[model samples]
Target chain A: MVSAQPAGFGHDTRHELIRFENVSKTFELSDRTVRAVENVNLSVARGEFVVLVGPSGCGKSTLLNMAAGLFHPTSGEVYYNGSLVDGYNLKTGYMTQNDHLLPWRDVVGNISTPLEIRGLARGTREARVEQLIDLVGLQGFERSYPSQLSGGMRKRTALARLLAYDPETLLLDEPFAALDAQLRLNMQIELLRISRSLNKTILFVTHDLDEAVALSDRSVVFSPRPGHIRHIADTPLPRDRNLTTLRHDPLYTRMTAELWDLIMPTLQETRGEAS
Target chain B: MTNAEIGYAPASDEKVAEDRKRRMDKARQARTRERVKLNLIRLLMIGGFFALWEFASGRLIAPFFISAPSAIFRRLGGWIWSGDIFYHMGITATEACAGLLLGSVFGIVVGTILGRRPFLARLLDPIITTFYSLPKVALAPLFILWIGIGMDMKITFTAAIVFFLVFLNTYTGVRNVSRELISILYLMGANEMQVLRRVVLPSAITWVFAGLRISVPYSLIGAIVGELMASNKGLGALLVRAQGEFDTAGVFAALVAIMVLAVIFNTAVRLLERRLMPWKSAEQELEGAV
Candidate 1:
């Protein structure tokens, strides 16, 4: 099936990027039980940019984190390319909400960290690092430490780090939630462009509806806190999607409105509204 | 704003900017190299101090109580050549090395276990802290009595001193690990052993190394104290015998030997730490910014 996809399948009909098979997660907090995610079943295809969007405290981040191997479901399995994920395989790169850059490393060194961990030769690592640094528009900031870089620059460096290792899949858990509005917009566009160009599968988590619409092939709207899957809305945006045109599309508005309606009731329920 | 108004200048302008950047980068590299050179110079200054002290004592001042550097070197050279220095150094080294190995091993294993397991951490918290806080050096006489006037006494003394430092550092390391990081490792399919080896050990190594660096000097002190009280062959015993006979120069020479050995050992440990922890710099930089 995997070999057939590369040779015969249409670009959109490529093999599933990741599959969550009957996943459930539970937590025992001081004898007080909490069911975090209940029976989530979904499959994301190769090169698809999927966003798990919901209000804060929902299991959106948890779902994305599970895909990153940062959290395991209490039951069921997560399969990548039809193989079960049992441990951190390093094949999928994860970007955390807070940019977890090692402060002592310079921008180029930070980007090349996974290569260092994999024990790549210095000469090859340096060449790859330079390529990533330039791709992220951090060419001049190679020697600068994370401490010296602005928040936006740090995030950019982190993104470069994610791309440096050429992971087939990328999982982002509210990666740009800490950025200001303008920077977030810029980053979202860059991220989308990079994802499409690299043809990498991405599972991005966010609470912002506009961001989900802006970047995702499909946006999965989740229920509020201790979430269940509410709806998965697919956008007919092309692989070469653009921000300027997305806002102009009537279809974008229609899908966003549908997802917003799904989220509104859940938000009201969490807020204990009489309605 | 228009693209031109946003100052999307020609590629040549950007290339010029890049050239300036290259120069600045070279300057920064040079500065870092200079800083390392300065640290080496400071090390040489310390050596220079001992040389001046030896020359002034032997030539200018009376050499009765103060030993000349040359004289001390000559004595050290004879001792080394004839293997007498090795005998004394070997005794103290054996005690210190054994005690350090046993104590650090016990501390890391026990400390990490207790730190990770909440029930155990809570159960032993008070008792562990109390014993750790108490100065074990003062109990050297008691240890000598317990283990008899042999190498056992020195080993026990060194072990007692080393244990608490390593235990506290390792405990702090395990306890301070990022909760989010652990969850990430688990989600990655890391089992208990993998988590310990990949996550816990690496996370705790900085603290364990810190503890090791601190406890090594204490190990030396503990062994010396044990020798002073009862041992017949270690460096401490040599110093005691020299002092009893009013051979102050001999005592000073012994003290100099210990200092040189200590400095060498400490330097080697620091070099080992640098090789092991390539990740440490990033963490430090993050902290500095915070």
Candidate 2:
């Protein structure tokens, strides 16, 4: 909503932030053993928007979860900042599909939860939480509970919560998948603007090819279950590009279409190769 | 598609959506009304039964085995005014209250210690459950022998009843908390105590409330049963004395007093629950009034 520098955000320079070295995950169910991810070697760079796209049960989410330190890899190591992640840390903020805001907490309280967890002084935390409320365009509804807000508003509140801690890296799990088509586009534009201003590294998981191309600097496509990389594509779109200019980019359509094509074959292959 | 053709489909979709929403609203209203009606009927039925008891004992039936509601009230009034009921009520209340508080504290501490440590939970779960399952009434003689037949026996019995119910419920509640919620909190830089304080405790509140509701009744039952086994002053002792002397009216009166105490305690606890959980009402509504 406010003007910010655009040129400085567009650089394609990469710095290694997180690296996955031959990571694999296996889950044991009552009657079956499922390998959710398999030898997935991937790395996310600082200040880069990395989107992981695939179909259902693609292990894309599993791979992301491992990177988030939600699950331990069965075989390999995930190094963040050149060190293996031991347990959960505040340095990486994860926003799940469901906005896990406590019902008892109002918008301001929810947004400041990370700060509260860190045990920041009440006065400083309150001031920063108010700033976040304004930053997210949620000024008037600071006192509203999650139940009282609309779908888009709740997502914004959750995003605000993620941003309040100002984590070095952000992990999003299909954050806008629940919104309507029009609202999803609006949110995409807003997310780009915020991400640009913050210059934070983000790893986003999504099913929509258009979303991946429109939002991410590079897209990693996963194969099927026990997911491995099918292909990785880099988009030429600038970091400051919003939904309007992103859709109008000459290379945008081709990038999205190519990703769709790459993923479609895997979907079909997985189905056929299964029972 | 032209605007004219597209227009009708969208319009119909909107109307259908609106109709469904209206129907849903009506259904919610109907359900709320039914809940209110059920509560009112329950209250009226209780009152009506009391009135019928008064009428039967006073007029048609002989007031021998079953005392009239009016007679019980008059007897209660005399006992209270003459300060005779006060000592007995005080003894039972003190034993029940003391036992409940101490037992609940121990139960929560033990339950929490076991719940967080999975290996410990596994090792001690069977033993704890076995103790819980053993007939509580059978423990009365053991408690009497150990505590020597005074208020200590009553308190021990009450404690025994309150402890297991609370321990089992709290243990399950702690176990039932979502692992994801814990991880999220941990990632937010919460320490172990904070995770337990903010996440586990709040998640367990509803179950703890349920356990409290159940244990309060057990507290009263335990005290009364202990008194029945051996006590000189309590409603249970009064009932035993009345039965030995064939004072059926006195027995009925003592039972009625116990029921009244239970109803009052439950009502107070329900009020406390409502105060503690203002968020639960909104959450339930979002779950579609079910």
Candidate 3:
């Protein structure tokens, strides 16, 4: 990683990058209306790592989609940098479970895609792509296509691509959900190291409570369907703390237990309704 | 590791390399044997069919109905020596290639625009369907009436036949490009043009190439049939001429020439496919329908 300089993109004294004000989303399917999320109000500050945690189909992902401006809130507004995200907020980089790393392109081409889109000078774009390739530890696999690479390697390519253009915020939807346990842990640690050093505001959506505890400045736990905030707990773990040893920390265990208690009742209640 | 580290022995590593090479050589030999067996089977089938036909040509069945392979090859050789087959072949190839290239360009451009704009796609859907439903041979009389019996008329007919196929395939391909991929680009500060260039076109190109491969034989059919109907220049005209003279061997030779030409055109397309889409193998391309 070429030493990340936050001064390059020019962030002033403003703190808030994303703010969801009473945001509610209702999806109109063919047979039924799906109220994905209801009245979710949360603000993510600049350089903050916020993880949205919940059970599956709990609309945590819907909120991330809202922040990315893929879809608007049906009721209230979602804002970025004090402006309403009317359509396709161009300031964010999004990565989902599937790498979407264009099977046609090799790794270098995929990472350099955003830079090419922005029409950066060829030499500068090449240099940045080179730096990103190193950042994601994909140096030797630069010429390898996504289909040829392993799952973990493809995810790394996608991450390198997301960082190539240097978006102010990253919207990740369980980006490592498909990986094996050890690979997922390694990716999590690497992501934390990069995002922390680069000062990226990340809103990561995950169903795993352990992951939420491991990688966030604050954890916003959501209820079951028609998800709204169940609790917003500040992790307050040291940024430089080693994740491999962090589970031993009493604060980490206590917070995980507390968040678990908050989520269990909602899960049981939903299951009871289903039964 | 202890012995190698202490004494800097290269023998163990050399032995590992030799074992790997031997395994690779055995696999290569197996692959070659399989391919040779397949080719031998193909050869046997083709040769057996031809030998049976040759034996029956004059003895059981009348040679006039189904000429012997030897007689057909002799006629083909004479035509080659006289240099008439080359003329017909050149004219047919030119018309087919010209029509294919022109039709594909129009199909890709039109299909892309309509695929991107659903409103326009819907507005013109009925007319496009009607055009597609119309038969290629039926339009020959009208094409002759409009442009007359030159090479242009044949090329136009071929292009028209090719346009609809290429257009439909390209339209379906472009429409089915992953929404997630497009949205990701949009979020990455890509404009509509950038998104199309970066994602839509590349994604849809596999479809475009499929259409092109399908259009190759159809283009040849278009030119040959048009020549058969009116023109004096192509292999189709040579077939018509042989039929008029009641020369069974000549007709058989011309048919064989057409078959060879078809094979050549198809091979060209496969080669071009390999060049254009290095990322995908021929079999791998047929996936991603959704």
The 10-residue segment with the lowest total lDDT in model 2 chain B:
B1-10
Model 3: residue B239 alpha-carbon error in angstroms: 0.3
For candidate 3, lDDT tens digit of each residue in B142-187? 9999999999999999999899889988999999999999999888
* Model 3, span A1-275: residue lDDT tens: 12211121222235888888878899999999999998777888889898988877889889989998899899999989989998898889899998898878888999989889888999999999998876666666777667556677788889889888789899999999997776676678778877888898999998888899999988887888888877788886887767777789999999899889988988897887678
> How does each model score on lDDT?
0.75, 0.78, 0.84
Candidate 3 shows a clash count of 0
Model 1 residue A151 CA deviation (Å) reads 2.3
- Report the C-alpha lDDT of model 1 over A1-275, residue by residue, as the tens digit: 11211211122435776887768788789979777876677788888888988767677766776776657889988877878876564567778888777554678877776676556899999999988876656766777766566677788888887777767888888899887765676677778777877798899988788888878888777776567667777776665665756778887888778878878988888787333
**Ranking of predictions according to DockQ:** 3, 2, 1
TM-score of chain A of each: 0.89, 0.90, 0.92
Model 3 stretches astray by more than 4 angstroms: A1-14, A273-275, B1-33, B282-290
Off by over 4 Å in 1: A1-14, A69-72, A75-77, A103-106, A143-145, A244-254, A273-275, B1-156, B179-202, B209-221, B231-290
Which window of 10 residues has the lowest lDDT sum in candidate 1 chain A? A1-10
Q: DockQ for model 3? A: 0.36
Best by lDDT: 3
Quality class of the docking in candidate 2, CAPRI style: acceptable
The lDDT-based order of candidates, best leading, equals: 3, 2, 1
Compare candidates 2 and 3 on DockQ and give the better one. 3
Docking class of 3: acceptable
Model 1 Cα shift for residue B31 (angstroms):
20
